[model samples]
Target: MAKPFKNLRDKMSPQAQNASEEKAKKMLSEMPLQELRKARQLSQKNIAEVLSTEQANISRLEQRTDMYISTLRSYIEAMGGQLDIIARFPDGEVHISQFKEIESLQNSKSAQSSG
Candidate 1:
């Protein structure tokens, strides 16, 4: 018998949840730079400043579906958020950190980096 769509997956087996998490991670991992920047509620200029990159460069990076690690980190930091790539075993639990801890991640990056 088919169950109604009441998010019955709440009781989903661990294997199912792992697959769901993996899919979510894959999608987020490949998110375009612009979308990520916007999700952080930041403008192109702001992101460029943090990355020490030019506006044109930021635009270019965002257009691509994949980016360098440093570039990804910069964008994540610019949005006052941290990007955590987690690998969970079938039985393992995921622990997400508080946003406050992520806010100051790039404090060491100089503000003058942008021109």
Candidate 2:
């Protein structure tokens, strides 16, 4: 025995329904990692395939409290996204470039070793 789901919007006035719809849209836009992936029409399997990892690892990655920038960048890039780091202060915000520095450092080290 299961109860049927009702359309709550149907009971609302037109204006109220419109407002509710807008709120719902905003909330969806601010969803967490798992919801964002689903909203993008992707599954953990899809992400795992792109990252060359197992589905369980993707789930664990999403649940992690903190992760390395390189690891996060790999996950985001696999999802067709570019990761950006920003710093915000009372004055304003600034885009951090340390992530790029990691690449530059590696490149310089390799060049030195090769030369």
Candidate 3:
């Protein structure tokens, strides 16, 4: 008879356990944009209305492998979620601000006005 599936997590080392947990978290958090939209139970027509576009446009957008950040941001916001850009290096990961340039301009204006 075939052996039944075994839960090997109990026998894993602490480091292995941590690594597994991290992998699980990453898998749960990330997926294709179309999958994310469908998982939210949103229709293409619904997203099109939010973006003031046609359903066909939304459909085409989902099929695309590349798109502008603004387009992605708008689509994500339509699905009631925020998009974050991350930079990963050997040392660590950095969450890049979406509006850094705009924020910097505002900060500069504030400093100028205060001066």
- TM-score leader: 2
Off by over 4 Å in 1: 1-32, 93-115
lDDT of 3: 0.86
Report, for every candidate in turn, its global Cα lDDT versus the true structure.
Answer: 0.70, 0.85, 0.86
lDDT of 3 by residue, 1-115 (tens): 6644345777788999999999988976888878888889999999999999999999999999999876887899899987778899999999988565655677799899999
| Angstrom error at residue 32, model 2 | 1.7
Write candidate 1's Cα lDDT for 28-114 as tens digits: 867665767775678988878887889888788777777665566667777787667555779996655543355455444444455
Score candidate 3 by TM-score against the native. 0.64
| Model 3 stretches astray by more than 4 angstroms | 1-27, 98-115
Which window of ten consecutive residues has the lowest lDDT sum in model 3? 1-10
The candidate scoring highest on lDDT is 3
Deviating ranges (above 4 Å) for candidate 2: 1-26, 104-115
Query: Candidates' TM-scores?
Result: 0.46, 0.68, 0.64
> Pairs clashing in candidate 3?
none
Q: Poorest 10 consecutive residues of model 1 by lDDT?
A: 99-108
Q: Candidate 2: lDDT of 16?
A: 91
Cα error, candidate 2, residue 111 (Å): 11
Error (Å) of candidate 1 at residue 115 is 23
Better of 1 and 3 by TM-score: 3
